[model samples]
Target: MDVQEAVFLALDLTGTFVFAVSGVLLAARRGFDITGGLVLGLMTGIGGGMIRDVLLDRVPNALGQPIYLAPPLIATLLIYLIGKHVSRARIWIVTFDAIGLAIFSVTGTTIALGAEANYPAALLMGALTACGGGLMRDAVASEDPAIFIGTDLYLIPALFGAGLTILAEVTGLLGGVVSLVIAAAAFGFRMLAWKLQWRVPQPMRQWSYRETGRRMKKLPSVFRKPD
Candidate 1:
């Protein structure tokens, strides 16, 4: 493989490994058995890519090439062996998950672009590649998906990385250095959001007749009802 291809492969595998670690850690935190951990880890490692590949009408790398499965298996084994000594499993899970998020955001976009997808599709694919696995992991573990929770930044950073990748590719500025920068930017954004406890804005209250009335009263007389 060419240097660029090799780099992307490394980043992809790294993402898979980190995602697997996060999944296994979540299983451990939930007091799941080894079998549960293994399944969760594999889900988190390959689920997103599988989703992307299927959507793009290609066979999943993990399915077509058995080697793509190695990272998660190794990650599961390592965590099972050493997980008992690690405290704060949740923290590690979030951290490694962030790393995977960054990597997948970029690599996924690249894959979509390589597949000749348009810009919008590439952007969405990047996010799916970064988040599909986590969504599945949470569903399997019976936890709320962090992407939907909006407790801290999640989807935004993935989009940011994906957008940046698209911009770089379009501008002919994409390179190994640029790719790394994009991933770093994504990772930093996620970490900062976590550190600051940033959250996506939610509706202040459920929409209802009372809320409608209150809003109506706040409007200017011209815009309010004659009554």
Candidate 2:
């Protein structure tokens, strides 16, 4: 295969493994059976790519290539065989998820650009590709996803990766090396965010009557009047 094809394959494999581990960890946490674990693993591995392809108006790559599915299947088996034997499942889950996010963000941007999509669309596609699998996994596992909660810096890394890819393309530096560097930078950012407990701050909305009443007594006249 050529360099581009090889890069794509690497991204696919890396994403598959990361997402598979995420699914497996969730299944283990929920005490799912082996079959359930396998199903979740498969969904997590290909869910994002499937969504990306559908949005891009193409057949899903995972469906067309056995390579895309096999690594995840192997991962499922490994998780099943080792089931909670060596280390903390949560740590594994987070590590794999971070890797998957980085890989998918870069790969999705590359694919979108290859399809001749505009920069904004490419960035959106990349973010979706990074988060879609985790969304599916959370929905299947009946848990709230971090994206909506603003608890984790999940989407930021994806955005950074996508933005970097677009910047690289605009600057005429979008080769495999540059792409990989961008992906790695995104991954590093995510790791740092996780370590630092980075969070997207939620905006404070206007206080409701109850809150207003509670605090109104303490405020000066200028600020106390209702709209």
What local distance difference test score does each model get?
A: 0.92, 0.84
Which 10 consecutive residues of model 1 have the lowest summed lDDT?
A: 203-212
Who wins the lDDT comparison? 1
RMSD of 1: 5.6
Model 2 lDDT tens row, 20-51: 88897789888898878888888888898899
The alpha-carbon lDDT assigned to residue 23 of candidate 2 equals 91
Instruction: Put down candidate 1 lDDT per residue, 1-227, tens digits, no spaces.
Output: 89988888888999999999999999999999888999999999999999999999998989887877999889889998999998988889999999999999999999999999999999999999999999999999999888986667889999999999999999999878899999999999998998898888664554454566655445457767787
- Model 2, C-alpha of 181: deviation from truth (Å): 1.4
Q: Highest TM-score: give the candidate number.
A: 1
lDDT of candidate 1 at residue 144, scale 0 to 100 = 86
Q: How well does model 1 score by local distance difference test?
A: 0.92
The pairs that clash in candidate 2 are: none
**After TM-score superposition, what is the CA distance of residue 58 in candidate 1 from its true location, in Å?**
1.0
TM-score of each: 0.90, 0.87
